[model samples]
Target: MNMLEVFVSSLEEFQPDLVVLSGLHMMEGQTKEMRQKRLLEAVASISDIPMGVPVHLELASMTDPELMSAIIHQQVFPLVNSVGLNEQELLFLTQAASGPHASLASWNGVPDVGVVSDIVFWILKEHGRTPGKASDLTRIHFHTLAYHLLVTVDGYWANQVAAVAAGARVAGTQACATQTIDASRVFLKAPLEFATSKMEEASTVSLNPHEPVSEWHRDGVTFHYTPVLVCKDPLRTVGLGDAISAEGLLYSEIYPH
Candidate 1:
C-alpha cells in the first residue's frame, strides 16, 4: 500500500502513456475496515492521474459483492478509460450492478457471443463515458477461450481489427508456452456466425477467415471480434488473460493521435 501510494504520487515524473491496475482480489482476506481504508487511498491516488492519460483496470475473480460494488459505483470504474475481464468477472460485474442477465450464476461453456455483447454494451451505456459524467470509461477488452471482444466508444479509439487479432493470437502462444504458435496444436473454436446482441432484432455477424476480424457498430459504440486459435494441448492456462489484455493494449491506438 505504501509503495503504491508513492508511485501514484509520482505519476507526473514518470509521464506514462497508459496505467493498468490489476490483482485487487489480492486483498480478499483483509478485514473490512482495512480494505476500505486501502481502497479509499487507491481511489484518491487514481483520481490524481492527469487528464487525457488513459488508465485501464484489469479485473480478476472477486467473490465479495461489497468490494466489487465499491469499485464499480463509488470510485475506480468511473475513473478508468478502459477495463479488461473474462466472462466470470463480466458476469459478476453485471450481477453487482443489477444490469442485464444478472440472474446467471455461471456459464456452461464459452459464453454465447450475443449474451457477452449485450452485457458489454449495457456496461458502456450504463456506466461508461457519458456527457457531463465523471466516468471516462470508453473501452472494454473482453477475452474468453473462444474469442476476444474489443468494444469502444467510436470517437475515442482506433484500429480495432489489429488489436482484437493480436489478443487472440497471444492466447494461443501463451497457453501453449511457446513464442511461436504450433499450427497442428491450435484450432479455432469460436463460432463463425454470431448475433450482435440477444435482442430479437439484433444483427448477425459472420466471420470471414480471410479477414478473420468481424466488426459492427451499435448506438455510439463499435465492436471488434476475432476468433481465438485455441490450443489443443495446453502447457499452462495461468496469465492468459493478462497476456491477452497486454497484447491487445499494445496494438491499440488511441484516437486523435
Candidate 2:
C-alpha cells in the first residue's frame, strides 16, 4: 500500500474510465507472511478507486493454492467490475471456491461449451452482482483456444455480439502477427453448427457460419459466444489473453453514463 500510495492518491486528477490490473501474480515470490501482507495492500489499493470507474482484473497462470484462495475469498473479487481469464485461470478460480465443475483436473482438448456455460453461470449467480448481492462484478470475459464467452448482466453492458467477435478476430491476427487475415492459414476450432447449453438440459445453441455470434438468455443474464479463427502455425502464444480482453473491452459499450 505504501509503495503505490502516490499513484493511488492521484486517481482523482487523472479520472480514468477503466482500470486494469494484471500483475498480482508478481507478488507470489515472497514468503507466505510477506505475500499475505502484500495481498492486504492490494485489497486496499483496489477498494480505494472512485465509484463507477470500471476495473478489470486480468489473471495469469498462478499455482499457489493459498494465494488463489486469498484472492477468491477476499474483497478482491467483489471490488472488480469485470475479469478476463483463460481456461487455466478460470478452472483455478472455480477450484479455489469449490464451485461448479471443480472436480476436473484439466481438459483434454477444447472444453465443452455446455460445461463452460454452466460454470460461468455459477460464477455470476454466486459471486457477481445480482438482485440482492452487493458485489461489483457484472461481467466476465472468458477465452480459450476454440471460442470466447462474454457473459454479463443485461443493463450494465451493451454491444455484446460485436464485442465477442472483436475478441475472436484479434486472437487470430495477434497470433499470426498480421493485420489482415489469410483464410488458408487459419481454421475454426469451435463447432460450426451447434453447441449444447448446460444452463437448460437437452437444449443447444446454433452457430451460424455467416454470422457466427450465438446468443442466449437465462436467469436474468445474457450470453454471447463466438468461434475463434485459430492460426495454423502461430508465431506467438503468449499475451493472447490480454489481446482478446482488450479488443473486447474496446468494442463493449457501458450503459451507465
Candidate 3:
C-alpha cells in the first residue's frame, strides 16, 4: 500500500482525537500530476478524526497563484476542520482574495493586527461561500511572529483563554527545542505572569475602526487572539506553525465544552 493507505489504516486502528496534516510540498513524484493524485487520495482517506491543515506553502507554491489556489480550494480546505497559516501565507491568501491581478503593494510590509484580521475573515467568508466546497471548517487559525489569532463561532469551543495559553506553551516548547534546552524547563521555570503579559501587550493594539485589541464579536464569531512566546535568538524557524496548530487542537480536545 502507498502512504495514503497506510495512514488511513493507522487512523482507523488508533482512533486519534486529532490529526494534523502538513508536508504536502514534500510529496515526491516525477510529474505534478502524480503528486496531485496522491494528495487528493490522501485527503479523501481522512473522514473520522478532526483534522487541521497548516498552509506551509513552499517558495514555488507561493509564487504560483494557480497552484496555491488548487491546493487550498481543491484539496486542503475541503478536508480539514481548521486551517493554520503564517503571516506570509495569510498575505498571499489576501492577494488571491482580491482577484488574479490584485496588487500586493498594500500587503507588502508588516501588516497591523487589524489588517491581518480583516484578511483572515475575508478568507473565511470566501471559503464558506465557495460553491461545492466539500467541507466547512469550524475554526480559522492565523499564526504570526508576535501573536496567534483564532476565529470561530461563539460557544463553539469552551475557554478561549485557556486555548490561547495552550498554544503559547506549545510555542514555548518549540523555542526550547530550537535552543536545545531541556523540555522540562518550560513547565518548571516559565511563569504564568509572562504569558499574561504577552497577551496584554497584544491587546494594546486596537483593531481597525477602533475595535477591541484582543477579543471581539462580529458576525456570530468570537475572535480569540494571543501573543506568542518568542525566542530572541532561535536556532530554527521551520515547522513552528505546525507545532502551534497541533497544540491548539489537542488542548481543545482535552478541555472541550
Candidate 2 per-residue lDDT, tens place, 67-178, comes to 8878867778888888898899888878887887899799778888877877888888888888888888889999999999999977889898999999999999989988
lDDT of 1 by residue, 1-257 (tens): 67767878788898988888886787778999999998888888888878778889899999998888888887788888899999999999889888888888899777989889889998888788866666788999999999999999878888788999999998999889888888999998888888888854799888898998888888998999999999999998988898899999999988642
After superposition, candidate 3 runs with Cα above 4 Å error:
27-32, 47-61, 97-102, 105-109, 129-134, 176-213, 253-257
TM-score pick, better of 1 and 3: 1
C-alpha local distance difference test of each model: 0.88, 0.85, 0.56
lDDT of 2 at 198: 47
lDDT of 3 by residue, 168-247 (tens): 66676677664333444433221122121211233333333232126765566567776655665555557777777766
Q: Which numbered prediction scores highest in lDDT against the true structure? A: 1
**Candidates arranged by lDDT, highest first:** 1, 2, 3
> All candidates: CA RMSD in angstroms?
1.5, 1.7, 7.6
Clashing pairs in 1: none
